[model samples]
Target chain A: PRMKLVLVDHNEFAQAVAGADEAEIIEVIDHHRLSGNLRTKEPIRFINEPVGSTSTIVGIMYRMREAAPDKSTAICLCAGIISDTLHLTSPTTTSTDKEILEWLAGIGGIDSAQFVKDFFAAGSMLREHTPDRALESDRKVFEENGWHISISQIEELGLEEFWKRETELQGALQALLTKHSLHFACLMVTDITRHHSVLLVAGDQRVIDAIDYPQAKEHVYDMAGVVSRKKQLFPYMSHVVTKLDAP
Target chain B: PRMKLVLVDHNEFAQAVAGADEAEIIEVIDHHRLSGNLRTKEPIRFINEPVGSTSTIVGIMYRMREAAPDKSTAICLCAGIISDTLHLTSPTTTSTDKEILEWLAGIGGIDSAQFVKDFFAAGSMLREHTPDRALESDRKVFEENGWHISISQIEELGLEEFWKRETELQGALQALLTKHSLHFACLMVTDITRHHSVLLVAGDQRVIDAIDYPQAKEHVYDMAGVVSRKKQLFPYMSHVVTKLDAP
Candidate 1:
């Protein structure tokens, strides 16, 4: 018997569940930039949409199947949509996302505005984590061309707060570089109020030189008006590094 | 005022509808291999699916909107699905296509078996046309790497009948190559009964030479068990052409 797999939220072997390479992927429902040259011996259902959240695509899949999600499932998907789109303020939010959120919110019979406010209040506790814990939270690794890179993003209320932790954060990033055998590791500390970010890096010198962005210090660079890491930071640096002569 | 466009079945500036270059595209719904780097100033609804027919994706769109197609539209979409998938037997047909076809067939009150028999019988009327008309009936142009090529597929009852018209068909293919400024052009004469095809070629002898199959003539080769030009012939040759050193 063949082991069958169905991936939700994420695709790509490097980011998928453990033992994914040994299983046959039956379907993938995701809301991310399609990456990795995944080949299978059989055809698979791959639904990747440019939306705010994977939850939005999953909602659509449920609707297409003519099955209403359970109460808890609907609320969970609603939270995912709200979190990923940042209360509908992120540029990554799409009209379809807005529509699905409305449907899910109505099904859950909850005030989404109140829920989002509470969600933000809870997310602002980033000050509690040490630099290492902060880096481990919401971390993702990607392979751009042949360069394997890890990028993590965290939101802070104030730029000064992150700058104070710079030395400790840089140490965590360097540790990640060694642990993952990565060509590069980047951490984006975005100020929620100002909609600007400062990126800290630790990687191969060649990878650092390819950024196109002016570094504020030896390993930190300012990125203005960039809030979404997947949409902005990863794509920007990935294009630059792949165009460079070598990693 | 600005021109707004909605492209159906096809995308890509090179192969888009004429006057598309002068207009701003607002949406693209297609079912072919996704190609071209199309970007816009604003977000648009771009739906590209791995279904057998553009009609299959369109059918899902109609279903998602909760609006049923009229009888004529239902029949039309059903015919498209049946034709493109060769009655759900083509390699390109997906489970989604089968689902859409069944729904459309039910709505249109069609006996799919009878419809498919009539469809293929109608498709095998290539001998009634002059070679020029036959070539123009189902011509499609593609861009691979930097090279542009046109391919036409026709269903015939026998290989000998198509061989008799080879000179005249080659003339038509050469005209298409000159008119479209294509790097190459190919005509696939498929035997509907025997499930074999003889591919005739024009322009860019390097591309023809690159086909792994042994050539039966200067520009003709035997292709056994090959149907679905988009899935089989175009992809196979595109891989070869793109892998070559240069055009």
Candidate 2:
């Protein structure tokens, strides 16, 4: 059947659900960078804003249209905003995110301080998954200057689990480099409670040598207070690749 | 000095002002197809709707924010909506466009019927300008499948002036083809009062032969009721080019 789709949260067809290219995109509400490839037969409703989460934009729309989400729906949206913005601690958080989060939390009857603590403690990817699964859990591939770089992020309550499994995670990242023919592959284990992270990378030597973060060990870097993949690490990696010495 | 910009009406940087590539695009409110090349250092506010005119979107924003344009600004917006949608007669006209136009007219104390009559009578491109000027007055270039095609549109009260200058208009299109190294160049002379148009072409033989519109003469097609370049004629030309036999 021919389908009409309204894309939310993300816009790039690369990150969209399978077979989205064949569907007619009637509307898009996103908060990511435009990938510049999506085309429609005609103009459609598209709204992209620079907020911490797309859930923030959706909440704004509800207010604009004078519509109210059910309590369960409000809870879901609140979770989206909390998870994506790392409980509003991420640098990506805007004033809109803060305002909408409060509104949604009020509607959901959620105490945000308690909610944040419970959310981060609910799942520890480092402890629950095998090294390979943990590394692959939230991975994203980016193309920068002919380099295919894969970055995976895992959010946890503390760095204790990561320290215990660091060796195995490094091996998994190395395996990912070969399996995907990736120029660089890295995993960021972020301690959301502490608002810090440590990066484990395995890839081209020149790219690894370009890391300026204080080294925790041979392949790991202690990145204090860096939690955002979109606003922080991705831009740093893009700059490194852009400034790499000519082959 | 660096500058920040808010693009309205169009999104493609190719159709934007000079040095747009170097400027920071802070926001965009448009009603055209997204060409998708735009990239900002950070996520910016972007709103694109499938309405008849960008003015309609601005009017909507005004109402959404609980603000109103002054009388002169309202009149200008009305003119923009009227011109783009052919006074609510173009196929691109949406319910939003009609509603917004009425609101703007009321704010400006305008009699829409009389305004439409005076607006179309204000300028006749074919009568006031030479063939070259008329053809270049409202031109846009598009690149599709490696073909650089230039399409220009002139809106007039009637086709009488176009008929008087058809030969020179044809000559100008041929000149445009050579000057720009364009694969195809065409001019659409539209009669807004009657909601019809006539297209004149000078291009590669394969592309020219591929046009399926009713031929009015050697190089002109009678495009009855085809008043919109964005919604109607451009799509037809694109289809014609896409179906041309492989060289």
Candidate 3:
């Protein structure tokens, strides 16, 4: 049976709903670049802006329809934009994102600078949480090149904190990979102070074999200059996965 | 004095506000192709859909914010999209435009077949109205290439009907030129059945001098196959205006 769907935030079929192939996506409001050779059977309302967060688009929709999002919604939207763009410092941050964030900040009575600092400080306490909590907290799942894969990132105050918890984190990731039925799983423990990342990978042997980055140990790779997952890690690993799966 | 502005449907400053420079445009939700040197002082949320009507964008906005438009609003929106797309027959009408129009039709309880026939028949009475009413009914004013200009289009059942009213229409257009202080003005009288247009021109001597088309009379030209104002007339006239005014 043909059914109508209005997709928001995400567009990729993997990230979309279950049995997406059966549904007719009438509209897609997204901020991410088009990927997965995406094509619809019929013409759809596809709005993809080069912005930091999907929350910015929602904010614009609120304004256009002459509806004010409640104070909590404004605050939540503001927080999403700020957190997604790393307080307007992320490479993905667009001016449109900044514009909405500012408007939301006004509505929420938020001092943006103070909020970002507080948010980051709280995030840096990831090392204190149990390994399972850290693994689950910031996890993002994706199916890249027919691989049911996932990559989770944690922003830490120091690299030493991540190194101390490395073994336990890998063990937790292994359990997560099996639990989620993921083809592979990776955790990027990033030092927010130093702007460096240490990747802990656990997955199918083929996926592990495909990646040939500067390996720090058996499954850990030192990704020094990479911070953004969508920009740097996703494309890099997608290439590797594609090459390995090629007939 | 800085204030917030959110532009919809149209993009150009000349087409937009009386004093657009005074307010900072925070967002622009539009459907037309971007024209003029559309540079905002600050970053603005620009949502340009490749659809037929700005009303479709508004319809999408209403749904996104979970705000159901009232019946009257729905009818108006449906009519706007239908009229703008020439009852979903125009080349500029995208699938998204059709999709939104169908939804609006359901909401407004519109009989699409009956509505289109009536709309076209109603529009065909252009020559019967007073010259001023005919001129102002479907007029679009623009500032193209430093020339204050305007284009008015009329849908006619027969070319002879427009030819019958040519002199009076020109007289009213001349008054319009003086009233608006336009450098030039054009009225495109399109024969719906024949799919051809007879353009009535009245303006600055230089603009009249520049047109290389077969001069039907002192101020009329035959556009044998041109029907669309946005697609055919605007761009063609823009080039001519720019060339005539080139320093």
Q: Of models 1 and 2, which has the larger DockQ?
A: 2
Residue A31 displacement (Å), model 3: 8.8
Displacement of the residue A149 alpha carbon in candidate 2, Å: 0.7
The alpha-carbon root-mean-square deviation between model 3 and the true structure, to one decimal in Å, is 15.5
| Candidate 3 or 2, higher lDDT | 2
- Per-residue error for B205 in candidate 2, Å, reads 1.7
* CA RMSD per model (angstroms): 6.5, 2.5, 15.5
Q: Which candidate number has the best TM-score?
A: 2
Q: Largest lDDT belongs to which candidate?
A: 2
The TM-scores, one per candidate, come to 0.68, 0.92, 0.52
**lDDT, model 2:** 0.86
How well is each residue in B95-129 modelled by candidate 1, as lDDT tens digits? 99999999999899889889877877774445688
Off by over 4 Å in 3: A1-51, A54-84, A87-247, B1-4, B36-42, B63-68, B123-125, B212-215, B245-247
Which docking band does candidate 3 fall into?
incorrect
Compose the digit string of candidate 3's lDDT tens values, residues B79-122: 89877777777667778788888888898888989987777777
The interface root mean square deviation of candidate 2 comes to 1.8
Q: What pairs collide in candidate 3?
A: none
Model 1 segments more than 4 A misplaced = A1-51, A67-76, A88-118, A123-126, A129-247, B18-23, B40-43, B123-125, B128-130, B145-147, B156-161, B214-218
lDDT minimum window of 10 residues, candidate 3 chain B: B35-44
Q: What is the DockQ of each candidate?
A: 0.10, 0.58, 0.04
